[model samples]
Target: MKKYIFLIILMGFTTMGLAQNSVSGTIKNRNNETISNVEISVSDAVIQTKSNEKGQFEIKNLPIGKWILIFKKDKFEIKSEQVSIGNQEQKILDIILENEEHHIDEILVSSVFNKTQNENVVKIDHINLKQIQNAGAINLSDALATNPGVSVVSTGVSIGKPVIRGLSGNRVLTYAQGIRLENQQFGEEHGLGLNANGQESVEIIKGPASLLYGSDAMGGVLYFNPEKYAANNKTELAVNQVVNSNTQGSNSSVTVKASEEKFKFLVQNNYTTHADYKTPNGETVVNTRFIEKDFKIGTSFATSRYVADFRYNYNDLNLGLPEEEIEDSRFRTPLFPSQKIENHLLSFNQKVFFKNSKLEATAGYVFNDRKELESIDEIALFMKLKTFNYNVRYYLPDFGKFETIIGFQGMNQENRNFGEERLIPNAKIADIGFFGTSQYKFNKNLLQFGVRYDFRNVTIQEFGEFGTEGSFQKLDKNFESINASFGFKTEITEKITTRINVATGFRAPNLSELSSNGVHEGSNRYEIGNPNLKNEQNFQVDLNVDYNAEHFDFFANGFYNNINNYIFISPNGNTIDDNFVYDYLQNNAVLFGGETGIHLHLHEIDWLHMTSSYEIVIGQLNNNSSLPLLPANQWKNNFRANFDVSKNIKNSFIFLQANYTFNQNNISQFETKTNDYLLLSSGIGTDIQMNKSKFNLYLTATNLLNKEYVAHLSRLKADGIYNMGRNIVLGVNFDL
Candidate 1:
């Protein structure tokens, strides 16, 4: 009788939810123009749109819930509005963009989504809120799979990493709160140093940015930006919950922000836990669980022409793998080590404007540390890693609509490892470097470029047959290398912008590359290192073309990277101390790829809208073998429709979204094989307004049929493992 009662309640809720509703709106620029052909998106949000000609745009089929609307364009101002997709209120609105005056009159979106700034440095790619909310991600990797140039491999539900243009590991640099991330160097068992809960923006610098950000960035860099202020003087808060499609796991997030005339602050926290995720066949593949927490704080003061800003952020991560494989030769196969990592950042800046240019000085430090634990239920594992960074920059107002940016940065890093039974002495390595970047603009055409120089030194304490029992031998090794880069940006026309960038970059050997000793627990691989390694060099070229008009919006980019002295680990034919071991070696390789996105404004109807995007990558190692863990191809599509509620007492909306990822068969030499798969999901929601506060609610189902498949990087595949099962999520948001 109790079970029947619960079922009846569940059925009632399901029936009520299926009674879908919809919402709609129009976006326009200050010229009172429809701003057709412009892209509008929300970050760490749930809404997205494209304005049609006459600068008109709309979103339909939105969950009647509280959500933020973010407006963006290539050369226009950025705007955001808070509103509820209520049960009966029909909303008619337009967005206005001020000319390139440089003064932002609207929302403070993330760094990557900047619209008011003139095109200068590199063209950036983004993963906004609409993408996150509608992509049907049972997990973060599910959404990243939609990005063109990025490929994700997850070791079941707990392990995952982004493969950018065929590059992974240390070659892929990450940025959080404007600082280099330090977690990846720990081991393969670790995922990115960041989670998606509080992220307001994600920017991908697909090529060398070593100038503004010092060494270890030979491949590219990823930037994650969170909200700094609440829209207007209002307070913002929202909670999101999720249940995996294939896994019966649950996750939740709490986001809050407050700002006043003098100062502003915001905070975000997220949590999740799960048992073994299930496949469509109801099979329990692997038992996996993950726990993560992230937060950011910002403070800024404004007075006439003098405005100063400062921010601080902290990120924490812990992942457990149930059945990861232990192949001797593969990178993730043998699994380097299990990792529990913590990342931290502190930033400060001051700026003064003087008609010609704004003078600025910035300073900050970032620290990352990871300690390896034995994966075999508490056995001793060897490797430990950490990275620290510092930076400062000055920007001279545009020399006639142009700005020159000069900056210097410093970095310090250390890697430590000890042998258990081998009783081997510990090894140490130290690195330091400085770099600069500059930009010059002329009318519609802009010139951007930069250069960098880094010095690295490596040392080993005592080796076999060399020093006192516990102390004295030194084979201190030291080497130095110089790295640099340059680029060009041009506005071809009012509707088209193109950029070409060429630069030289490099990554110095870290403790793991030069020498690693100890048992790595998480990844369950015994670690060994080589002392004879050289600094690796890279040369890259990047080209981007963006077209913005009243009817269609498009973006496309191509990139090529050639590396000298590429470092990798492979089986060694010989043995060390009568024990089987592998050595870290360097080689040369080339990587290339491109991504494109398109927005189509259908015949403006009070009831409909649609958009789509795609990305791809290909890479070849020195042996001419395919690079490991590179994504093959990907695509995404979204549609929405609005219902007029003015005729009725209450208003409503309906949204429909679908995403697809083609086969990422691009296998590396070490990878045995990975299969291709696709996923689908949908949801409905609505909103209401009472007093000064707005209330929103919604229900979303992911992996509709509970399809089960292993992400390309799952380590439990041999054990017949699959990812999350079907999941349903309930969400609510409010703003005052």
Candidate 2:
């Protein structure tokens, strides 16, 4: 594989590139008024340019094919136009944009059809780069947890599990570089191995996406889009640096990219290290430090009828488990009882364009090595997971108002243990799924539906001596399911839009859930697996409504999920070796919740913006007992202002945010209640231009009031550990 990647890179560099195609356009507003400084970009390509003072823009050196041109600017409704680059040397176009009432919608590629939010039947949230930076999130999980209906289950400040609604651990799926991320996600201590540096943006499918991504997507999907290559016939070098006050941490990265008319290449390297985090009482949390190193490379080649993309990423991480002891000295390296993980991912994607149809295929491989250390030289637990996955899709020709797609997805996986301690047996897994989906549009209504069939097989090998603490039973299980989804979107009026979606999803038991027979060190409990556990299946209904006016926008969303044979772990009222014994069980469950928000842009004070949102979720079993690991209800508010300090400084903003988590009293039998708490945050950022170069500077402060509290979903809560307090971050980014 490494040799192949090198060969591809060599081919890309040696091939002579073509630069004949070109596109030129002019922008105008509703009254035929010229609009200047409008950003223009071509979809699936790195070509970009801005309209000049005369509202005229030209982008050169383009591949011959059909492309979508996107136009975006402040206070304007984002627009897209389809353009074809044939044998012609240059293509000219004129565009008109309408004034936006609220926020602009971005084009989404994660969805089957590349459409804007207002044009799709499903409700998808787009998180842009600005949002991620303004939030001052140190990791990907922390950035995701800010969205509604999304929460994080954290182990210290390093490892975190993303929970959608009330389901986590294997139920929620994450996709990066056009492939599923497989990193032993069945364990709660496992975190997202991918970094945020090379990502363009994140798209969240807040409901059942199994119809599109197959099994393990029963909860939802987080799609991380990779950054685009450099503009045609251009080379760019960029640097980013960040510093944190509380942990005395520093994060730095460097990126280099170049592109020709037919070939492109990009590379990035990032490193981050942090000392133990401090609490409100001015005491540092013991062994709460971590270090990460990541490297990414991407290359692509394009022609009139064919396009290929290749991406590879490597990550190395070392994290410490928080202990009760408080350390006064600063230590960047982890102590004993720490975790070391390494991940490597490689993906290849290709697309062939026909007269009116297209074929797309993607193949990926993931290698994950995880280890827990008992001392400087002794390894307590070690596991290796390898996965190979592939996907192929055919886009049928659009007929009138109907469009369709057919696809096949499959994967083969293997897991093994290399340490004396065994949490689960060695296992082999296989999966195959086929799906077909269609969309129809007429007048003001859009309808979408899909169906999928999936098969999964799990095989486990017995391990350890008989009648021993680490003994496991041999088992073979096969699970099959047929899932379907339906969605309808309608424009109620010029200012109102509504969406309704119904979907069914399923998940087969993981290896640990089916074969574990020993103590789980993470939770410090003896867990016995149930071989007879059945597949967990669920049906969900979702409804969303949005109202947009001159200066105000409001949205409301609700969902209800009914699950059968839901799997959970509970104490069996027994103890072994002074450790509590827990057994995996199955029961019917239901989860229901809703999220609502309002955004107001003052009509008179155009610079001021205020937004507020509330989110809640409830999960219960057939016996009316609450499910464990559910996040408490939360309410958040933000006030922001935007202005320009001078001509050299543009897109300046400052904001203040407040989050209030309500008390969680509806606890499961094995859990305890949590008290309510409020947190405050603030940030300011601006863009500075010097000659032909641009720089972005920002400062963010989290836990502004130094509030000391523990989140309900925190794994350290059992140890009476509080979250981090009063941290300020300073960031600088520049490109040349």
Candidate 3:
């Protein structure tokens, strides 16, 4: 495993060069004056310091234990505190600063039953980083398809994927910095090859988390949270640009960061290109062009009780495939039933602090390379997936209000195939998991529970030409699972809040559903696989409600799962080279969903704002049919206003949005029936500055009335195409 990830990153930089912890502080305000250059940081270490000019500040090789001390300056009000350090320690503190008016509600760590509670019971959905830089989305499932029971299942515009609530791909599960993202996601045209530039937020867990991430999370989990550095003796630089106009596309990125208090680093690079999109009756669509290149790097080190992190990512893709092209140029090249993907990822994380418990370790590696081509010098399917993952967690020392966690996770996978069609063979996979979770707090409620156990093994290596059903002779498989969960959160009055949860999940049947036999060139069918498919089992129940106030905000969520064998594919009336033959079946299923939202914030027009959301889902089966790539029934709305035309422009806004969708006729069995749409979008933005740099423009449009649609999780909607229409994006971002 790459020399065991380089001997655990050289023993965490040789224990950060013989540790020596330190933390010192002094910032003031609230009329106590003395706040000098502020900016002090230390959460997830990489240290940082500033305060100077008599406001003192010090940060030296820290890592002993709990930490979170952040305080910025410029108009103040970004404060944080939670400190602890020991062993060769030097600690001193005092800080206070508060002035940046309102807007603070963010802190969610993918809640596996409360990470210091910010409301939980398993309903986490956030997407910050300024809403992904004001949604100029071109990836990360198009910025997570604008939240709310998410959806996206494209096969164009750079291949998308992500559809929670009515499953998708390998049953959804993606976690970036905290590992668990093995690339070849059981292909429905792949694509989630990680790159949403150095994200600093995105957390979602809609249902079933398999007792905290095990076995494809049974349709949920998307976490990605990385990007943090540059706060103390900072150094940062940034540049971004994007433009699209219905896929004449473009995107560019660059970022750099540096920090010191105990080392920190970040670097990012991105490049994307697009073409061949257009369709609002204006045709184009041929080949559905795409191209991308991404790069990332991260580093960290600390010392109070040790902390370490390291990350690396590299991706390259060139996908184009919308067969039967009628060529209307704008080519970004990939021609001939194309696809070429390359991904590499590495991760290392560590932490150890014990005074009240804490120990975490993570290791990951993934290298996926897939290729498919049909004509330009034929290749046809080339798969290569290698994954090695590990995780360990412990935090059991808080017995005042009770809290505990224990974990272990594992994976080692391999899949190989080289060209000339081989749908699935050459495989070796192993996984292990063990878990325990707990949390408790009385008074205002909060209670949670957990248990998990899992084990899987798959081994296959056989070739064709012997008694042929595409021959597959050598195979071994074993799967075991057990899962559980329970949760509750309260505070039912003072502006209401509630949550409830129950969970259980599992999935084990992927090697293309246990060893497929032939032809599956990305859904042209002719597949077959089902080594007695069993082990799908899932169960879920969730409910949530909230009602914060200051100027309104509401939410609601609901869920129901239930799966049991559930693994589908269908179509057995036969047809061969001409495609159509499918198999892999198992039944019993059910899915139900809900989401609701409201935001408001008018209070006598304080810069007008409004919001709305709605969603629904229903998957069925146990003979009641319906459930094949489902997703429809949605609603969204927005209004927004907020302005400030002067002071060099400052955070302005203007919005208007509406989305509708609804009309899917619940399909299954060869599915067909789409129809309904309703788009409309708008945008505007601001933030200028000029003397010390800070730009950030924006402009958006998107289908504004050019409507001709087609989306019901469009995998090109079974070949009737039509989905991209009016676009118009434009973006800019700066800081140097």
Candidate 4:
């Protein structure tokens, strides 16, 4: 608590040291015609403004030093320029744009350098939240799964976990509001613990990213960008509502934002509730209901030499464990054997500008309280976790086509138990890492390389009576490793581009894997942990090729990852308390996969578009055995058309999609094979502008044929439970 107060005070002082600066600009097209409503944004800041009727725009409260400005508009090519803010009170500039037909690429801030996807050496996939909502996704994970090379592991419709390239659980990391999210992710049934409300977009890094995010990123990263504040000197309010047919669910949110030249503030409240979901055979799944309540508040302040942003979020969830088969009811309250989780997150980001360089620091604190109930008030299991993490980086001035950055990252976490049953011992974990990376540009080609060293310490406290069932002994462990990454991106020709990267990553054993000594609830398994497990390390190589033309585009991405000291669990042919016993083990593993897709626009019918993609992954151990919990291959196709109905109605569209999952015959020692299945869906949406208020309306129907199919990654697969059946969603949104 003292540390938090000290940091806040420091930021307050820094933000008041100097006066603010401003920038003004004018925008025009190649024909020398003014372009009104063009968006102008600062690359790394949350500040943005639109051009007025005269094609003039101004953004205030900028810090001193260098900044990148991006200009974007429909039917025009995007442009970027770098400018320096010195002693001038305000900088002025004029820009021109060219006509173009391709989609505008957004600036990617997740990378070291604030460059677009096409300009960065690393390959990243960026998806807008509006696009996901237009596709009628019920949750964030389901929306992300629509992208190639991504899948979901689900306990039910309400609980979905993200899986990237056959890696789930703790291997992948999630970031929100410019800080890492920590929410007891070692459990298989643990969900993402985040809502889609107030999110602008998501950027996915599909390979090892230890070079940037340190540990727990052996697989990849999912960075959620929050919705920006209203344009400078603007105040806005929005309301959204959605209803679902399958679960008898309703989702609603309200947001308000106010921005000034030097200060911005926002607040949002979201609520979601659902009853039991029904299958195609008119059978309702028992104890599958859930309710979530979320609240968020943020503020930003800037000066001539310093910028500070602070955000706070509170989330509460009442999730049901679908292990009971009792009578189906439409009650919003969850049944017994349920989970109640409450999470609180606070993030602070500060930037200090120098004459020739800059410094950035970010700090975050998270508190998670989790409880499981056997009855109305009887707590079966409970755990509370607290975490604090920080990152600091120094950006060196550009020198001879070179950009470099050096940083330090660290985290401190503590776990405690307060229930009758304990799954793991009370523990404390500490992590520290140091890294340096640089990017070199030459003739439209980019080369990037980096190295990092990390250390982790784990300390466990003895719990219960030692040498007995469900008892854990005290233990201490330390792990250290060095990792590195290299990448090169270049254009092979005017129409073709290629990117190749090689990176290494490492992960320290999680608490569940190192200290478990009891029967895990809901899984029906007795698990024994390995106290002397070695660190899991991996090296991966990624390749990407893209071809662009007037009427079509094609892209292919492939990767090969080899891991040493990979840890997994297998049955030990023993039973305890009428439950199968499993023992943790280690081995060398390999996973290889790729995604290929092509999109085409009809030349004669300008409004018609078609897209198809295929993704496959194969995971194997050193002994030539298949790995567990791997998703099957998939193929997806989409068709869409955009047209206008009237002058008041704009951007109207209709879409049809089909997805096929291949049969999974390769099974692990304790797994079963899954058959193939196909599903179809469709939707229609349009934007309407009334006299004063703007509105959006959409209707989406999933599982058009009411297919009865089970996915390979479903935890309920063992019980012969199928996925959700035909469902429809009606959504409406309006701005004031």
* Descending-lDDT candidate ranking: 4, 2, 3, 1
Ranked by lDDT, the better of candidates 1 and 2 is 2
For all candidates in order, the CA lDDT equals 0.58, 0.85, 0.79, 0.87
Off by over 4 Å in 2: 1-23, 29-38, 44-67, 84-91, 98-101, 325-330
Best by TM-score: 4
C-alpha lDDT of residue 653 in model 1? 49
Candidate order (TM-score): 4, 2, 1, 3
Clashing pairs in 4: none
Best by lDDT: 4
Q: What is the lDDT of residue 379 in candidate 1?
A: 33
lDDT at residue 725 of model 2 (Cα atoms)? 90
Worst 10 residues of 3 by lDDT: 100-109
lDDT of 3 by residue, 133-190 (tens): 5645667787787888989888877888889888977888898988888877878786
Instruction: Give the C-alpha lDDT of model 2.
Output: 0.85
Could you tell me how far off, in angstroms, the CA of residue 685 lies in candidate 4 after the best superposition? 0.6
What is candidate 2's lDDT per residue for 1-736, written digit by digit as tens? 4334433532343222344568887899989999997978776554566788999887765555567888988768888888877643589999999976565365645687767677789899887754676668877788888888889999767888888888888899999999999998988875998778898888889878998898888889999888778766679989999999998998899999998767889999999998888888787788889999999999987765566789999999998876655444447998878899999999988776555777777788899999999877888899999988788788898888898999988888899999879888899988889999999999999999999999988999988786678898888889999999999999999989999999999988888889878899888889998899988999999999999887899999999999999999999999999999999999999999989999998778878889899999999999999999888999989898888899999889999999999999988987889999999999999989898788889999999999989889888888887899999999999988
- Model 1 Cα shift for residue 582 (angstroms): 3.0
How big is the RMSD of model 4?
Answer: 1.9
Q: Report the C-alpha lDDT of model 4 over 651-709, residue by residue, as the tens digit.
A: 79899999999999877888889999999999999989897578899999999999999
